[model samples]
Target: MAATIPIGPYHVALKEPIFLKLEVEGERIKDADIKLGYHHRGIEYLAMRRTYWQNIFLFERVCGICSDAHTTCYCQTVEDVAGVTPPERALFLRVLVAELERIHSHLLWLGVAMHIIGFDTLFMQIWRDREYVQDLLEIITGNRVNYAYNTIGGVRRDVDEKTIRLVKKYMDTIKNAFDKTVEAILQDPVIEARVKGVGVLTHEEAKRYGVVGPTARASRIASDIRKDDPYAAYDRLDWEMIVFDEGDVLAKTLVRVYEVYESIKMVNESLEKLPPGPIVTEVSRFPPGEAFGRVEAPRGELVYYIKSNGTNVPERVKVRTPSFMNIASVKPMLLEETIADAPLIFASVDPCVACTERVIIVDSRTNEKKIMTFNEFMIRYGRKRK
Candidate 1:
């Protein structure tokens, strides 16, 4: 007989709220199910109520970790509909902040990974080094996390000579420390034993699941929107898309570990090739049209679709986050794996529940009057566990 185990919505291994129902025989998982929608903020509907300009701020909040990517993607879509081109300098600045955010995000993931593996010392070191990137972001964008650097027409702020010098300085700092950090991770026998061949997602499986970011790259898919469909200043920059055939936990770690160096190179090159011009252009109005925007966020490819009906507000807005694409594959990765490896495999994808949480219900008859706590709602919905 198989026993069922529920891992989240909230658990010691999960930082966010996503439930995993695993059926296990003794220590090995036989099958698995994923459940989301614990927190939905109705961002799509809110976009319709706000003006195009206001919606930028609203969309930025979609994922706190990827806020810049969300806002950038949203603005790109809106710009496409409005037929407004941001200045060259603004584009480079946008890329600058985006890369900085990538460094911060990847390091955050690295810290969390170390914590997941019970390596608290490395976790502390990684986060400590991450502060330099955050400091650089604060210096340039006036805020650390949500930056508010990207606007519809262009970037809201400009990078001064002092800040540009500081960026180069910090990039050098990151480069100096890169080899040591990677050595610490890859050379350790313990990390190797825990991650080497665990949670293997074959290349075909990655394609079938439509996985993205480091997860797919670790599978050697070599699919990246920045390379395939160049956006922002990526067309002007040159960088390699990291890939590894192993497609295990270690491969995923290696892909992201090296990506930090790639991002740093892009940031430095963008600054060196920085153009000078107006940061933003005047926006008259949005004509009726539709446009799609895609960005290679730190996590993966993030896409946004917008339709405008010749109004200040968008007619419709849709977001397709990378986490939503990658989370489904967890079901396959969990099959036949021991329960001990479950959390690590899930973490290997760097799943972002914040991006995927949503719920909707429709009733044709009349207005309903009922309010219940989440526990009651779960019980009423027949989710009570045996």
Candidate 2:
């Protein structure tokens, strides 16, 4: 028989401040109880207070790492409401920026994971190389973390020839670095032991739990928002979605590594196929209605629901982030797994707790109050949380 043990709501190992309660029975995890709301900013609620233009910048701050994804979703939602499509050049530029963000985010994650596994040497190496990507982003977007580079109809900055050549050189450098990093992870026995088959989620379980991004792809789930639901220049781009069936920590890491190469391809292709036109299109007012927007973030499919009432300000903004959805698979994955393996399992989801998810809903009849964690509600209702 196994006994229960609680792990977080607080832990020294985390740089991020989100609370997670791990239930372990001996060396194995009996269940996991995640404690959320620690990082909640109520950005969705605040969106109703800001004008559509202001909302773009505000929403971008939702997650510093995946800021580009947040901005894209918000921009698309407004574009959906205003019934506007960005020009071909603007769309291509958007894709370029978005892919650059992905490479940056994934490299950052790789370094963090390396640090987690006591691979400080690898950690320093990856982050040191990561600087190149960051510099490229800074040169193009001005700001590193929250680019504020995106607007309603199109991107704010234009790529000139000199800037284009610089970005191309940077891309080549990082691509080679990424290749070396992947080779190390694949060839090193220690890295293999730490990651491979440690936490496995079958494809069926992944779909049932609504896992997304590298996590779901590791389980052989072909659910990239870019592929399934095309937005921006994604429809015009040529790339194959990567997937794996092993569904382990190693698989997820492999997906990210491969994705870095893939994102490099996207950048090179985008620059090669760069269109001729202006990058930004100015628009003051947007007609209002409801629109759902989704984008394939570095992590997974991020969903945004926007409700407008014919005003400059939106009536409601709801976000169901990929981490929020992917995190749900943690409980089931942890069950019967070793305690030491818990962190590896959690990492498989690649969740950004700070920028993960936010939501609100009202009942028409009683208007009763309800605020509960998604996992708890799912356990109570006899369904897997997602």
Candidate 3:
């Protein structure tokens, strides 16, 4: 007889609601079937209902963790369709905010990973340190989470000398702490016991599925939208992309940990060389056409496709978040791995469902089709298992 283990629609390890139907035999994951599109907000569908300016903020809400990335992509797309270039200073500041956001994001991921491994102290410490970046961001953009920094033409606020100095000081302290955290993570025997050599993905397999971000980099794919396209201030900054040849959970963790340092370096460089000018350009009209933009978000490459019909509102707006692509690789990774390691491996990609600002879709082979909240999933699963 075939045996099955149903893992949430609600599970403790899941930070949010995601249904993974796992087919298990003798503690080995024979299959992992994913059910997404359950939390779709129809944000893209709302583009037709709002003005260009309003939609920027709306899009930012698509994924709270990856909000700045969405804003960056939205701004770039608007700039392209409007045929306007932001001030060089605006571009630099954009990079500054992006990198800072990235630091917090990766730190958050690290904490979550630690939490999954029953190390709550490390999780708490990582989040506590990450708050510094959020504070710095607030000073620059007026809000920590949804900065609304990226307007149509450029960013909304300019980084003043005082603000820049504050950021520099913050970065200095953050970098030291960041380094310590990474070292601790890499050196911890418990971490290696759980992560090292677990959940491996080959470079060829990663590339074939068009996996982006640290998940792909851990596999030695070395594809970063920031380096490849040189968007925003990346071209001006002096930094290098971090990649590893081992496609394991350890490699993914290390790739993200190192990226925190690279981001700090890139942000400090941008601030030191920050130019003077208007942060935003007034874009009153957009020519009818299609424009696409992609940004290197915390999770991976975030892409936006926009179609304008000679109006202040976009006719079509589509976003492909990195989490969407990275989530695909989970199924392959789960095969043959023990259930205990599932959480660690799942978190390795740092799947930010909210990052995609997508909806969840559940289709079943059997006649039973239902959607439940994360809480509901857990309650039902616990009851069923008992």
**Candidate with best lDDT:** 1
Task: Assess candidate 1 and give its lDDT.
Answer: 0.89
**lDDT of candidate 2 vs native?**
0.82
Give candidate 1's TM-score: 0.92
Q: Is candidate 2 or candidate 3 better by lDDT?
A: 3
lDDT for each residue of candidate 2 in 173-291, tens digit (9 for 90 to 100): 98788778888878989888888877888888988988888888989988898899899888888888889889888888888888888899898898889999888777766776799
- Cα error, residue 147 of model 2, in Å, equals 0.4
Using TM-score as the yardstick, the better of models 2 and 3 is: 3
Best by TM-score: 1
Clashes of each: 1, 1, 9
lDDT, candidates in the order shown: 0.89, 0.82, 0.85
Which pairs clash (backbone N, Cα, C closer than 3 Å) in model 2? Answer: 8-20
Off by over 4 Å in 3: 355-386
Assess every candidate by TM-score. 0.92, 0.91, 0.92
Instruction: Please give the lDDT score at residue 350 for candidate 3.
Output: 91
Error of 3 at 68 (Å): 0.7
What TM-score does candidate 3 get on C-alpha atoms?
0.92
Query: lDDT tens string, model 1, 1-386?
Result: 89999999889899898899999999999999998878777677677789999998898888888899999999989999999998899889888988989999999998888888889999898888899998998899898888888999899988889888988998899777766778899889998888888899999999999999999999989888889999889999988989999998899999999899999999999999999889998888999999999999999999999999998988888898999899999888889999988999999899988888665443347655444544465477885333
